[model samples]
Target: MAGGVAAGLVAGALWGLVFVAPRMVTGFSSVDLTAGRFLSYGAVSVLMLLWAARGPRRVPTGSQALAAIGMSVLGFTGYYLLLVLAIRDAGTEVPTLIIGTIPIWVMLLGKPEHLLWRSLVPGLLLTAAGLGLMMASPHAGTTAAGSPNYWRGIVLVLLALACWTAFAILNAAWMKKHRDVNATEWANWLGVATGLGALVLWLVAGSPARELAAQPQLPLFATLAVATGFGSAWLATILWNVASRRLSASLCGQLIVSETLFALVYSFAWDGQWPTPAQWAACVLFTLGILASIRAHR
Candidate 1:
């Protein structure tokens, strides 16, 4: 359990770093950057899958094959699109606020009633308060710190969370169905599938023309995209899954907050965008609310 929590924290930290990398990759629209990432990841993932599978394996059922395709689209295609857009437009601070939304998402999806309209009142209130802080935070608009597409950034982050949450739900079911496979093997192959789907999605969205026209970010964005699509997406998933197996679901849930914490600290320390007192207060209140909600769930 301790190992799992520790692994989760490590994964979260890496993801936080990757989340900030997209903004550094110049010229690519968020979509373009994402397209570049998927293209690279598809290549890398296939190689890894080949190495893992050792040339030949038994064929999958029609249903299982379909599940892989569906998972690829839902988990990779949807989530990466939203995540790239959010990071590109929002800078880094605004997305920190969105990370606070995950616990509520997990809880609302069939958490025990005792933690809801009954015994868990304090938690419910705290969660609500945290959400209020997030929504009320001055960073929620289209003019965030001089950025042009501020509101779009906010919406993009929320959409990322929605895609990710749905992915998690489906993933749990997928794991149960494929319990016979080693967890690592399942993850590696699914990553291969997801990368392929992302590539198809990218080409269909007109990446080649965009890449030719928007050339300022080719080398830089390609680096970030590879780091993000391959390392963050694949490696992080592998680590998080290992950790999730060891940790309690609730603890696993709370550790996600660590990513926002890491991102904010890095952004503040490096970018010199010192969080205002209001932002600090909001962050503290948000943490308290999450703690309250977690306790309530228990």
Candidate 2:
């Protein structure tokens, strides 16, 4: 269980890089960034799949393939598109706060036996309050003119939250039912699915290549894309699978709060300043919530 918790934390640290990526490449549309990152992710996944195939493993049937595609669409590709759209249109705070609610949803969707209402409710409330407090920080504020479609952005992000909650719960259920399906292989399949979706997105959105060609920061953009694709998407997915298999859905959900914590740390680091007192207090609350959730399992 401790190992699972650590895995979840490490995955969160990797996933936290995603929040910084958009800010790094502000010129690119959310779709463009999503496409490029997944393209790179797909490329790496192909190599991994091929390497893994050399070993003796059970081949997946049609149903498993369909499941992988479903997970990829809802969890990876669709989720990314909506998340990017939300961040672009609504600014980061709203989208992020919406995403922060994923743990609550995950707990609700998880196995009933794992949920201890007594401890779980307080932890979730604390987590929500901490998330709200984080928004009060200067770092969460956006200077851009208000998005005309702010409400649309909220809807999009909420949809993303739904997609991810489904993915997390369903993926965990699938893994639990099929113990033979190794985490690495499953993660690779999802990566392949995301890559294919990226292709479709690129085709429908008028290739991110043209957008890339027009930008002077091509090298920087490419670097960020590859780095995030490999580290944030590919590797993080694998680590998340490991944690998912080892931890209960409810516990795994609470651990996701670590992503917000790491994101705030990254934000403060980017600003070349330490966290404000309120931010630090929010961090404490988030940590306490995680601890409280763990205690529920006992």
Candidate 3:
């Protein structure tokens, strides 16, 4: 369990950096990024799938498989699409802020938090205030319908958060109940499905295979995509599986909020563009709000 907690933290930190990737990788279309990531994940999954198939296979059955699969779609594919959309439409800050609210979203969605009853409103109010404060960036202060792109990105980010929370919860359940049904295999199947979906989308969008293919050596880009999607994600889930075994679901949920802190620090280091003091203050407030929200639930 200790090992699992450590792994989970590593996974969480790795995930925190993902928000930076879409902003970094150049010369790739949005579809390219999605396709590259899933395709690589699918390739790796196939290898693992075949290896496991040749051995003692502990694949999931009816309900477990269904739930795991649902999680993959929501957590993996849906999250990626929304993330891509958010990144494309708005810059990183907006999407990052939306993602910052994920713990709150998950907590609110759970309904029966194990918190001190009176603290719920205070926790929630503080967190929401912090989020609002973050939104008040001097440059980004007004979220008018004026910039469809920015608002669109914001909406997608929120959708992504909701989807990610659902995925995380279900994944925890799956890992808890069906210990034998390997999450990697589950992820493999999901990646395959996502790759296929991307393929179809690619064809529909008139992006020729020739386009991705002609780029002499897109293998690195595609491989990185795969690693981030399948590799890192699989590792993260494994860590999550371990962590959940040790921690309460709610506690684990709270710990997960720390990813935002990781993201903020890393983002600043990765990109020299720091938000104004107001933005930083808002982020700090939101972090406190999240802590308060978790306390209320406890």
Candidate 4:
């Protein structure tokens, strides 16, 4: 359980990078970024598989392959595409706060049979309090509330939230049921599927290669895509799968708050400003919520 908690936290840290990645490459569309990142992830998976060709490898069955593709869409390609669009349209803060509620939903829905509802209250309340502070902070709500784009972004973010929340619960259940399917293998399979889906998405919606090449920040875009693909998408999925296999989904969900906290840290650093006192307090509360959740789970 301790190892699972650690893995979950580490996954959150890596996942946080995605929130800032879109901002880093303003030249690229959301589709381009999504496609590039997953394609890179796919490329890495292929290399890894080739390197392991000399050793024993477990090829997934048809059902498992189908499951991987569906999960890849819900958790990787579709979720991220909508997230980037939300950030582009509504700015980072609002979308992040909405997504931050994922933990609450997961916790409520994925509660363990042995754990009492009361046992979860402390963690849930602390997390809610932290989100409240973040929402009330002056740095939040950057997009004008009245704007059509803002509403559209809100709708997109909500859909993204639904995708990921379903993924968290279903993925955890799938991992628990299929204990023979190791985390690394599952991650690789999912990566391959995501890559395929991302390719289709890119071919359909991504900016032209010529246009992308003409941009001054092409190198920056490439760097961000590869970095996030390897670190955030591939490696983080492995870590998250580890956590999901070992911990209850409710516990794993609570740990997702780490992503939002790390994202805020990265965002503030990017802007060359420190978080306000309210933000700091919110961070503290978020940490406390994780601790409380861990204790309850134990």
Clashes per prediction? Answer: 1, 0, 5, 0
Clashing residue pairs in candidate 1 are 142-151
- Highest lDDT among the candidates is held by which one? 4
Model 2, 54: alpha-carbon shift in Å? 2.9
> Would you list the clashing residue pairs of candidate 2?
none
User: Which parts of model 3 are misplaced by more than 4 Å?
Assistant: 1-5, 111-133, 139-148, 182-200, 203-206, 215-220, 275-298
Q: Which regions of candidate 2 are displaced past 4 Å?
A: 136-139, 208-211
Q: Per-candidate TM vs. native?
A: 0.78, 0.93, 0.78, 0.98
Measured on C-alpha atoms, candidate 1 has an lDDT of: 0.64
Q: Per-prediction RMSD in angstroms?
A: 3.8, 2.0, 3.8, 1.1
Compare candidates 1 and 4 on TM-score and give the better one.
Answer: 4
Q: Provide the lDDT at 193 for model 3.
A: 62
Per-residue lDDT value at 124 in model 2: 84
- Candidate 3 residue lDDT tens string, 85-157: 7877877666776787766665555444455446556656666676677667654423233466877787888
lDDT tens digits, residue span 78-165, model 4: 9999999988888887888888899999999999999999999999999999999999998887544656699899899999999999
Between the candidate structures 3 and 4, which one is better when assessed by TM-score?
A: 4
- Writing each residue's lDDT as its tens digit, candidate 1 over 240-269 gives 776555544444555566566566666666
lDDT of 1 at 39: 62
